[model samples]
Target: MKLQYWGTAAAEGLPAIFCRCETCQKARERGGKNIRTRPNAMIDGVLKIDFNADTYQQSMKYGVDLTDLKYLLVTHTHSDHFYPNDINMRRQGFANYCGNKTMLTVYGSDKVMASILPMAEAKSMAGLLQGVLVQPMEKVQIDKYTVYPVRGVHAAAAGPLVYAITDGEKTLLYCHDSGPLPDEVFAYWKENGLRFDYVSMDCTSGCSPMDYDAHMNLERNIAMRDRLLAEGLADGKTVFCCNHFSHNGAHSLYDEFVEIAAKEGFITSYDGMEVEI
Candidate 1:
């Protein structure tokens, strides 16, 4: 499987809309990787993690064939992660896109499902929507993969989720926009001795004064990595990565985060970053 990072910024994106913060200013000065959009990812060009607000820009930047996506797994209905209106483009007569009449299976909690269902209905996108699969805190098969949707400690009303996916051979933990692991999720990992080939965590605050609750910080990520390793849930071979940065944290702070994560055997994901498993 091939995984690509589409975007790597928190809600407002790096160099946020009209902020004059030093970090945002620096990001504007140092473009490239320092520049970030909303958070999203693509797996094998078929499975997409989220349909962010910046989906169009990400597609254009990476030349991603959006029509190739077969499944879309949504973590929550957060504006940065879910933008159902953009998905309407897949509807017939909406746009002349390439690729076959792709089927996109979206899985999420009830809140996310509710948010997307209306859009899918209005656009008459049943052919493309496939269905809204409500996620549970247990492993379930979707297409050819086993996906486990774990409850996350994010917005109480939004009903956030974190995912652990396995395509028979390799496992990937998509942990983002979430705080510390819930007890059941940790128990499952501990009892099963689960090890992920790739782990993408939420690192919204990079050594900033911002307190980490729903999202994590550099210290939290490092501590989480240590715990995963100590519990045999991670190995030296595991590719641990962090993403979803906030503009307040700044671009230079992200560089510092990358440096710190590198020392701890973690990769800092950026837009267009790809990994094959």
Candidate 2:
């Protein structure tokens, strides 16, 4: 599996769209890793984790061919993660320039559908978006992969979902657009003998010491990472990646953030970063 981190910032992004804070300004001065867009990623170039406002820009920057994206697994209905209206760009008259077939299979919660349905209805996009309402513990089959929607602690605007994707060999746990993994999800992990080879955690906490009601800080992420290690859900073979940052965190510099997380055995993610499994 090839995991690509197209954008690693939280909703506002680094050098936030309209932010005037020192953190944003500092990022503006020091480019490169300091630059980040909304959180989004791709798996093996075939599956996408989430869609944000910067999806198109990220795709272009990373040279990603969206036409090959077969499955789109959404974690929530957050604007930074799920941009329903932008999905219409795949319609026949819109992006028909791609020579290959471009049907996208979408999986998410009911709230996700609510966001997509209106946009899909607005356009004549028929087969462009094949959406399936997913629930916790449901195993959805997409080609050679099996996807699981794990529960997480987060705001209930429309309810949130995290994903566990596997190809019968390796598993990747994408935990973001979420806070901590709920007790039920851990129980399911134990009950099903589930293990992850790759774990992309939410580090929105940045350098913060406390956890959010719907997000994780560095301390909470470390605790969660350690717990997963002890529970056998993660082992020496696991690739623990930390991403999805907010400017509110202690450090705005990517190198500084990576250094901090590295002390606790985490590889900080950056835009256009790709990890092979």
Q: How does each model score on TM-score? A: 0.91, 0.93
Best by lDDT: 2
Q: Least lDDT summed over 10 consecutive residues: which range in candidate 1?
A: 248-257
Clashing pairs in 2: none
lDDT of 1 at 108: 83
lDDT of each: 0.78, 0.82
